[model samples]
Target: MFSSHSKLYRHASPGVQEELLALTSRLRSVITAQGVVRRTTAAIERSQWLAPAEWSALQLEAMRALALHAGRRVPYYREMFARLGIDPRRWRSLDDLTEIPVLTKDEVIAAGERLLAEGGPWLRFKGSTSGTTGRAMAGWRDRASIAFEQAFVERQARWAGYRRGERRAWLRGDPVVPSRQADGTLWRMNRAENMLMLSSYHLTPQNGAGYIEALEKFDPVMIQAYPSSVGYLARWLEEHDRNYRGKSLRGIVTSSETLGEAERRIIARRFGCPVFDWYGAFERVAAIGTCEHGHYHVMEDYGRVEFETNGDGTANLIATGFGNRVMPFLRYRADDRVVLADPGFACPCGRSFRVVERVLGRVDDAIRTPDGRHVVMLDWIFSGLFGLVEAQVVQERLDEVCIRIVAGPEFGHREEQALLLRARDRLGAQVIVRIERVAQIARTRNGKFRQIVSRLSGSNETDV
Candidate 1:
């Protein structure tokens, strides 16, 4: 959901908000599962078993179709192809993509409507990405693309052994409860999907016991959560000498952030289940997920991934997506990094996808509030904002956080107030926030941007 809809939901009473949230999820399930989703998912499941060469042949065909469509229709790629003297008809292998320049996020922002197809690209819709950088980029998606993406998510769950209608818990960044909510009620049940939509923002060391108690009552078979959000609870369980008492829990699936090995061990130990880490981008240009064997495998059939190797053994991802023709990205450079497996390494699962040794970057520390809230996936606070170029949050004390921002020309007190209100919603109103305007926010030593940072010492993890 976009931030605009979040603002509207914020206006409703908490009781009405829960109903609205469930209604929205129900409606989306109907639309996304309509026609093409099931068929596509079955086809992908079959393709995963094909030989390596056969998989490559399938990807080459999809790349040909998407590239041809872009060249003949989209104004941006049409002009680019014309200037470069390239013929879409003769596009043969994955190597042909190198002829066109690798597109960057800045280029996509500047190109605007030129990136949009002229006509007949069919069923286009707008989408925005507020990733770990805290920068929002607007793009488009088609109906067919949305279905394909949903199929990919379902496939990952299948890999984790989640059957249809199985009870699960969602511990993501969605504000399921109001900020001022007391009484230790942090979750609302979605009977339609058999899901417990838990508020990730309200998780703190103080009232966190209630979360585990509620989960034991629900006894969900699967728990899908963010690494940071669930890690807090996992550590709390260990420190308190309490194991996760959900008798039906079979496994844990984590996504939207990097999973540290230490956190993975603790989570697996506390919950008595394997942790499956999933990696994907908002651009739909790349994907990586763990199999039943706990091995990371890049979903080669989902997208074509090329890598630029760094001196430190990590490789930057360069991708071309098969889905989302409304916003087809050819040779788009996603700054995310990963390490690849050694040659001849293959999974015992018998899938043809490439093995990934490790996924790097995308690690944001949880913003711990004085009230015990461990705030994760802070990209929501930066979504759908205007006149903000870049922003970063730094926590140096238990009760204070500094928000450094590169303000645009239209940024003023109104924008600043909105930000302050958003922070209060997650971190609690009592936490002090000092907004600082700067020309730029410094990147990491690897030229990576981190939006949510924590500087509190001895507060990283528990000693259970």
Candidate 2:
């Protein structure tokens, strides 16, 4: 298909595209059920493989090395260490870090300007995270950190049956650049026919149809995306046809949000693919990924995890990446909730990473009612309410929770009433529950949709 006189078209020949497509088809075939199961099982086996005494020693050594590195190179750490009158050389274990005091988001923000002014190390590249609260936080990382992050992701993919150089479509919130401007002609990432980049934000009814069309053309081996975006496309595909599985995708890898059972079933059924919900965050750098066995295994060798307790007895998860250098975060509170996996539980596969039952919710989501007499868990309210494709709980007034729901076609008066009954039972008789059918729910400026939102800025006076 290459024209003799044309230069760009030479690289875009039909034979080249066909060759890429054939290669991708082979890659997708490797993503088998047996592979996913082995990977999932391997996580537990790997963890169990670690001798307790050996693991503890390694963790302590890592912690000591990190503390010394931070104390010497990072200005903030140097100042903080001096303020605390601590000697970096004297610190030997992870427990010594507790004496350093916790660094809040405000402190990080204040120090950020100075950090940027310092221009960072030459080897480091700029990376920004929409921190736990969807607030912007900037940091720097070296090439090693980037490699480690890639390794963790690739390792998980391998476990899930994906091999290198496979063609997979990435559906992300961020749109790929060098996009087509003049016409409908789509540009593949690096002119690779097998890999297609689709925007998650533009997933409207019309755009979703277009997305399906693109998927048919790309014939990717796997579909990797956020659960919400995938759900939107999956539902659209199912509604459009009885058997709407895309031509290329054999499996789906979902991340960045809680994948409800209702969500998993819908996407799996609609796409005729297994949906594996991997858990990770920007703060922690893809720390954990779930296997087909539905167990979440931490990439333990990559990072150390710690559980902190609030006065209320709730557990908060903290992670420290041993890989990052430019801005090493040791025992950084990830602001996620998790419960430990059973100690003796072993998976048949042999890679060693600790497992987590599930990630409950974010730290800020649990709210204190107006009277201060009750605290409500957002997940409790959402427990069995996944029938609604999209939902948000808005606390604009005390004793009143405005529930905005985007209902599916199956949603009816009876479903609505059942939801109301559940809410009333949870919120109490005095609380007023308002239900509304809205075209769209308002997202935070950072483009994060909170399942539960509160306007109260630590103000409780509005409660009656």
Candidate 3:
């Protein structure tokens, strides 16, 4: 399937390439959409009608199957299991999974090819993290795993009253529009997906009205956006006393960041729709989505999630993905902190998926450029920095920005120049870019690291 699509795309003209790409995207979406509907329907039925003990038994069965598969097929897991004195045959229950040590990002990076499954006839798709938390990791996913994730996402959208085939507006980190094109139409239509893709990097207070106008004209049934971008729009609407109440919008789906209470409320109030937030990563290790009842529910069928409780009443999320047989992530420490909801607590919507009180990671300020552009998720600026231990972007003023880097032995003038060039490319050349080599970058009082810190007035730190 991949080869056929690649051939068609390769032979197409530039104008035809866009259409072919959209066609392929839509084709994949259609295939995944079928699985999504089927799996989500079954999941809803099981969560709503099945007994708690029965649901738990199903999860346990799935976990055991995944663990045994990992032990037999994945080299890293097989060796780790043997070294830890764990017999895969005896791994009958979720409790036995603890015998395997938590898989850290560092461990995954170091393990390299050893973590991939052997004797795989399945196709693998390469994916990587955004490195927003200073630790970038890459991995592969099988087709089934990708389908399962899409199913979970579709289920979340359904929970928020969005039906399939609805027109939607998307404002995420994807560079769908050319950064240099500063004229008309800040958004492009993806006719195949029925989506209007807006540029996240182009949103500013001065240009926000243009975005709102585009959204209003698009008349989408839903908007899937990064929390920070939607929050900024909501803030603009509130300050200007403008409302988007009469649009076709039914709900807003936010992902790739922590949605704060304030941001959620503001977005919900301004858009006159429910805000559904999702938490997951490219690792496919875990997934948590918001329900209509305003609760975050962890999808147990997608992954086996374990919580490591901290002294401050928060817990670090560790997950084991079941569908990715090509590269199984067993007990992978996601490094995301979450406040675990009480086990006895139940949502009004009555889904049996476990609840997460909140995701407590990735809070950062939007970098305001000299041209009044607000840029979130600045980690992309430091991409391809091989020996960068950690980096932070701090905006002291609208025109002045400082980047602090903790470099390893391999980092030098060349890598520094690359980083500077990227930064200048994103922000205009007029903005002062100072690169400082530092021993370490400081964390917040809560010991969490932020990638972007803006000291500009009214630029509140937001997640994702």
The most accurate candidate by lDDT is 1
Using lDDT as the yardstick, the better of models 1 and 3 is 1
The runs of at least 3 residues in candidate 2 whose Cα sits more than 4 Å from the true structure, single-residue gaps closed, are 1-53, 85-97, 113-121, 132-134, 177-189, 192-194, 244-250, 309-314, 339-344, 361-464
Sort by lDDT, top down from the best: 1, 3, 2
TM-score of each: 0.93, 0.62, 0.88
Q: Which portions of model 3 miss their true places by more than 4 Å? A: 1-24, 27-49, 130-132, 383-385, 409-418, 457-464
**TM-score ranking, high to low:** 1, 3, 2
* Decoy 1 TM-score against native: 0.93
In order, candidate lDDTs are 0.81, 0.60, 0.78
Residues 1-464 of candidate 3 have per-residue lDDT tens digits of 32212545435444554575477677776545366457756875465445667667776787778777888988898887788877756766678778888888888888977988898655677655545567456688766667777777777787777887889889987655555556466666777778887878777778889999899988999899999898889999999998875468888999987789999999999999999998887788888888888898887767789889987778888898766788888888886888888989988876777888998766677788766777877766766575787888899889989998889888889989988977876776667899998998887776777888888888876433
> Where's the lowest-lDDT run of ten residues in candidate 3?
1-10
Model 1: lDDT of residue 195: 90
Instruction: For residues 25-93, write the lDDT of model 1, one tens digit per residue.
Output: 776776563577878888998998989889888888988888888998899999988999977568677
Error of 3 at 290 (Å): 0.8
